[model samples]
Each structure stands twice: as structure tokens, then as C-alpha cells.
Target: MFAALAWSLHAADAELRRALVPTSRYTPSELREGLCAALLARSSARRRRVVLEVTLIAGVNDELQHAHQLADFIAPIERACFDPRRKSGRTGVLINLIPYNPTYNRLAEGETVESRNDMSTLGIPHYSFFERPSWERIDAFQDALRARGVWVSVRASRGDADASACGQLATNRKLAAT
Candidate 1:
């Protein structure tokens, strides 16, 4: 996604891409390797695009520091194709920050909604968690991203009234199970 902005359309995908982040599943080095591989994949004509998607759960990963860290991560890629003599303005990477939905809670065993647990259980041995981000937090985070020159956007809340959106699936299944 970052490198492809500078690549010709023929070398990239027509639609923007996506990738889940905070991949609690992998270590920092491993994450770096994954990003490098994606970049290499694009530059080498093996793939067209790669969009890094990170869900910002209100107080969890919505911190300004997270934005900075993300910016730092993609800075080098942004400069990779730059030419001082030419105005080769790059379109840059598209980062889609999705705020968590609370329709279905992924509480840990023995955990309850009143507990206010903000920790993530992803990639952990055996755990899951869920939370939602406030509109204010989302705005501020997007501003931070803009300051970093990163192309960032909040994934619009879709199908909220459908009762079948993300998180809600579990609830729907439970109701059916009953």
C-alpha cells in the first residue's frame, strides 16, 4: 500500500487493499519482515498493493503514540521512491483505522463488561476481547495521522442497524442457539 502509491497502476491493484494489524500474533521483527515482504512483493511485480489495517479500540490502540509509531514504520517506504530533482509526489499508503464494535463482546473467561477491561487478548494463547472507540477519539487519531502525512481514514460504521454486522454475529448465533 505505501510503496504502490508511487508505482504505476499497471503495477498495482485497482482497489485499495487491507491488512489487519497489532498482529499480536507476531513479534516486532516478524511484523517488519511481513511489511518488507509486502513492499518487496509490490516492487518486484509479484503483487499489486497492500493496505495495513489496524483496529483502534477506544482507549486501547487509539493513542497518539500509536499513530506516531505507525508513521515511523512507513516513513522509509514513503521516501524510498522519492527523487530530489523531481517532484515525484507519492500518494502514500492508505491506513484504514477501524474502531471496535461492541455488538458482540469477546470478553475473556470470567471477564464481564462492567470490568472495563481495555487489554487485548488477540494472538494470546487463549483469549479474546472487544471494545469500541468514541467519536472524539477517532477524530483526534485521524488528525494525528494527517499530521504525520499518512493517508488515514476511519472505516465508516456500516450495517449498524442490520443486527448482523461484525460482533453481532455471536449474539445472533446465541439467540438462535436458545
Candidate 2:
């Protein structure tokens, strides 16, 4: 119950049981709508606008979903635009980046090349957070991506306190041990 409060988008439809979750799930838009509708059909809510934590192009599953199936998949949403014309509703998609954490990725920059490319291919509005894109090239990051309204939130390691945010929780372990 408390977890639901943290997410801004919630559905009041009793048959739809979607609660706000920290993690994300990505599938065809119709599937996402159907899933949400099923959840709403069962849950109780005074608020219908709930943030759906969905992965646009993040994990292994994100890679497997077919882009062409979005419209039929999201039919439960009725009028949800693949690319929304306006931002009036409380309902929004918290699009998480894929390949999970992009930090130790010695492979290609999945978020930039693959995920972003795929979302664009699907015409879905998305937001990305880079693990460690070279600071000098942020201009390229901003220009190539943000200008399109696909926001990229970079991780800031401002110091020890900021270390945890960078996924370096072990930094605290040494201090606690001493």
C-alpha cells in the first residue's frame, strides 16, 4: 500500500491492479494497457492516474518484444498515443533504460545506440540515464538525444555521499568496518 503512494500514476479502475513499482516492464502498448486494465479491475483506487514503470528498451525482454505490436497491445488504453500529443493526464510512462545498469558495460553503449535507437524506431517517448558516459561528450549526449525530448539523466558522483548514487555502495562498507 505504501509503495503505491510513491508512484504518481495510479489507476482507480477496480479491475485494473497496477500499483506503482520501482522496477519497469516493457511490452507492446496493448499488452501494457491490458496488464494495467487487468490490475485496475481488481484493485481499489480513488486516483486513476498512476505512473506505470515501464521499460522501453532496458533488459533482455525489452529486446525481444516486437515494435509493430504496440497499437494492438495497448488497446485497453483506448486512446493512448504512442507519441502523446499532450501531457494533460496524470498517467505517464517512466521509461527505464535497458541492459539494466550501463556502468561496467565494456560492450557497446546499449542505452545510446541500441535502446534509444529502438525507442525511436517504435516512436515511443523515453528517458535514459547513463552510467558513465564521458563527461566531455555530454554536449553530444544533449544534442543527439535531449533535443528530441528523450531526456538523458547522467549519474553524478559529487563525492563520497554521491558515491552511493553512482552504485558504489561498497564505499560505505570500508568506513563502517573501520
Candidate 3:
């Protein structure tokens, strides 16, 4: 069994992160530190693949600055996982960039507004609202990560019609709107 932490590391998008994951009290920095430690600990086992999953939203976590922050954050973890010193070293680290799985606007009863307000409580300009990112933007993000020598892949969206894929639920709603 592979050991992994599927964290939504929205580097600069802390508000969105907090909104999406309400269980965690850790800030973005704390999450990053904790994740790095976990990655190292998991890599020490030497029998599992260390995977870090980051959900990238169009205008939220897909910016160039966020990519740089991600690279810096994961560089050491990648090294720890891929080190060539130990007998069971070079286990490898895979970073999966999943685009945001959009959520439908449940505004029939003012729920959407309430949710928006909730997101705004974090002190940032509450802005989790996003659409699918452009192909160029995605490419730039991938390129930035790869430039840092990190193994990365843009996860393909699956089950869009049935809304099983990332962002498809919102996509479905958005489609209905248009």
C-alpha cells in the first residue's frame, strides 16, 4: 500500500483552502511544514510511493507565484524521497495537480451567498469562484513544476458527464446556466 497525503496546498489561496477543508486549523505554512515532515517519514519506509496531491484552481492556486511556492515547499521532500544514499532510496515523489472540481451554485435558498460569506471570514478577498483554467495556464504551471525537477502531472478529468471528475459538478451547473 502506498502512503500519501492528498493535501490541497493552495499556497497563496489560504482562504480557499480553509473554505474547502474546514477540519484543519493549520495555516498554509503549517500545512506545508507538516506535509514535508510526513513525506520524509513516509519515504523512510522505503516500500511506498510518496504522492502529494495539490488541487489547482484557475484564478486561485494556478498562478505563477503559487507554483514557485509549491516548488520551494516540495523541493526538500522530493529530495528526501528520491535520495540516492540509502539501500531503499530513490523511492520517487509524484506531485499530482488536480484542477478544482467546481461546485454548483445552490442559490435557490441563499445558500450560495452564505457559503461565500463563510469563505470571506478568513480575511482574504473571498474568491474561490473560478472557471476551468486555460490550456496555456495549465501548461505554464506544469512547466514551472518540471523546471524545479519535480515529477508532476495534470490529472485528467474523469466522469464529467456524471460529474465524477474534478470541477464537473460546477461545470454541469454552469452549462445549465449558459
Please, what are the lDDT tens digits per residue for candidate 1 over residues 1-178? 3334331111011111111222244444454555556565554432333455666665556677767777776665544423344343433456777766656545557976446422224321111344566888888888997897777777777766665554444443445444
Candidate 1 stretches with Cα past 4 Å from truth are 1-25, 41-48, 79-88, 106-129, 166-168, 172-178
Ranking by TM-score: 3, 1, 2
Selected candidate, larger TM-score, 1 vs 3:
3
The lDDT per prediction is: 0.52, 0.31, 0.65
77 in model 1: Cα distance from truth in Å?
A: 3.9
For candidate 3, the clash count comes to 2
Off by over 4 Å in 2: 1-34, 42-46, 52-130, 133-161, 166-168, 172-178
Q: Which 10-residue window in model 3 sums to the lowest lDDT?
A: 169-178
Cα lDDT for residue 49, model 1?
37
* Candidate 2, run of 10 with poorest lDDT: 13-22
TM per candidate comes to 0.60, 0.29, 0.70
> Please, what are the lDDT tens digits per residue for candidate 2 over residues 95-122?
2221223322232334354543233333
Global CA lDDT computed for model 2: 0.31
Pick the TM-score winner. 3
Residue pairs with clashing backbones, model 3: 101-167, 102-167
TM-score of 2: 0.29
Question: Can you list the residue pairs that collide in candidate 1?
Answer: 1-50
